[model samples]
Target: METTYFTKKDSIVRQIWGKADTILFIFAGAAAEFALNKAVDWLYYTGRLPKDPLGRLFSTVNYAKVIVFAEEKTAFQAIDQMNKIHAKIEENRGFKIPDWAYRDVLFMLIDYSIRAFEALERKLTLHEKEEVFQVFLKVGKGMKIADLPTNFKDWEIQRRSQLQDNFEYSDFTKDLFLQYKKHLGIIRYRLLLEAQILMAPKRIKELLNFRNQSILIAIIPFYRLSRIFKIDYILKELILPKDYKSDIKALDHSAAH
Candidate 1:
């Protein structure tokens, strides 16, 4: 009898496993993980253990909305993450998640996480989903939920200083946010960048034209709000500039004219 001749011709998914740029992936993954942890913590904190039963339930629903809305707006941050995942896997091997597909994955993750909580005991309807997303987005995004205020300050100082050096090239109001002195306030410095991105959403190419060249700061803002004057952006933009923070003249300039 001619015994079994089995050849597993089927190959693994090229889409799933890309390559292995481990270092980049780790840092990128850390960012993604960090965001999730904070959101989850928010859930836990708001999930009333005792107290008013109806109010506690409402709070949980409110929190869920925040998570959903976050995904909707910051969906691109996750898409950007695919590049991180793709880059790492591509290094070892070669696979990819297309740009078009990224949006779906982001929504799926957002919905799944919330649905999971709702399924356990609370029966969630689609209407509830919509309500949660819109409401949370309005409230949470402004709160700077995941980031510390100091980070926001550093970025503002750095961006403004850099702009001061090259303000002539300033196209529009690409505001850089710094902490208000002696208090927790984020001040904004104008930049040419925001003028384009916000003023004209349809002319996307124009918005990105000055990207890499806009301001190459070592401290990249959290990949999520890399666009905004986020704190992570500050760490990378300010801490890494050559002699920027230490140069007494620059410091004086920041204070003076």
Candidate 2:
């Protein structure tokens, strides 16, 4: 059998990020953070996000997917490029982006990887989960994000504490969310909110007034059934904007190799 780099090399990360559904779920969870975390407001403070929040977020997700899916050397170069971007942002702002905020984005990736995989596929073994964490840990270390935990277990503890300290709804948060709703339209926006509720930490959901039941809790079985009949493609096309169709379609496991 011919094995691509993903199947032969970083198979664990490939499997986690290969599926469109899994990547979309991960994006949804990150979207929740972008809307509610005050520390990340500088992302939108430049007014780029207000003009195109979905496009901005989709670009970030695409960058992440490319880094994970790229070959070893290329992946390192991608990380270096991202770090350079961060340096520029800090240089322009005259202050460093907080270490905690950097960690928040990393933790969000780790947390949502687990959440997305568990919900969309089988539960990951502890070692498999550690593999997921290790990939991002490597990237975080490469970017020189300070004070990342030594292991997945320690990271979980830090993740919980950081959530308590780092996030709050601010004016940026409110405006960004309204932009999301405007861009996604009403029905898709409602679905996005429902998915966020399902994927977010409890504190985040409560803060966002998502204390009510998530529609996704009732839709998972149906979602799985749709996959069997290939109805999920239609579902995705309806939910995602036309401009993003090609980008969303490009998120497959094959794309990783």
Candidate 3:
């Protein structure tokens, strides 16, 4: 599925068949990614540090990019270079980012950057445009928007109403209903913390599963990593218990072996 967070790919499948499963998948993705983003931000701002310079660089850049640019990739790249210097210093400072975590963060940022570029380049549909705007709102951008419900049935009426009153809704109005009618459309979506975090291209239509009255339903993840106590654990757990016991294992395993 294209959308890691209740997005385009799932929406498309829901359209063709009106399947509840696909709709739920999209909502799950959205909520999952949304929560992860927020938690990552909170943990980061709390001054937690990864034992690697690269991780430091990635986290810093991610937070700054949102605050400063609000999804503007142009600005992200501009500061990204400065972050390179920080990366170099981190090595000597006794902090080092692992190759996997480093790669994951970079991949996600790249994916998001590409999406931003495409939307600007290709004139996104009115609803698509609103989705992007809502993304910014979720990430703590300056512009304020309402917190949409994660349920399709509830969101369908609420979000449409918001768009109608808040945005310059013209031809876009019909498009929203059509997408929803297809049963592949989403009223709400989010990101979350989970075993496998799914990520998707920024543009929903770009997902591979696009088709007519489509038979396939899909679920995608931003990506997944094992959970742990974030004060410090140089190694990624990749899998762990849901309760507090697992964190004990994480802390011990993290000790120099």
Which candidate leads in lDDT?
2
Over 1-257, each residue of candidate 2 has an lDDT whose tens digit, in order, gives 54233122645677778788888889888988878786866796567878998888888777778877776677778888988988888898899888888888888988998888887778888888788888889878888999989888998889889888888888878888899889889998888888888888887887787866677888888989999998998888788888888878888755434
TM-score of 2: 0.93
Q: What is the lDDT of candidate 3?
A: 0.30
Full candidate order by lDDT, most accurate first: 2, 3, 1
Error of 1 at 196 (Å): 46
Ranking by TM-score: 2, 3, 1
User: Please, what is the TM-score per model?
Assistant: 0.20, 0.93, 0.22
| Candidate 2 residue pairs that clash | none
Q: Lowest-scoring 10 consecutive residues by lDDT in candidate 2?
A: 2-11
Which segments of candidate 2 are over 4 A away from where they belong? 1-10, 253-256
Model 1 backbone overlap count: 23
* Model 1: per-residue Cα lDDT at residue 45: 33
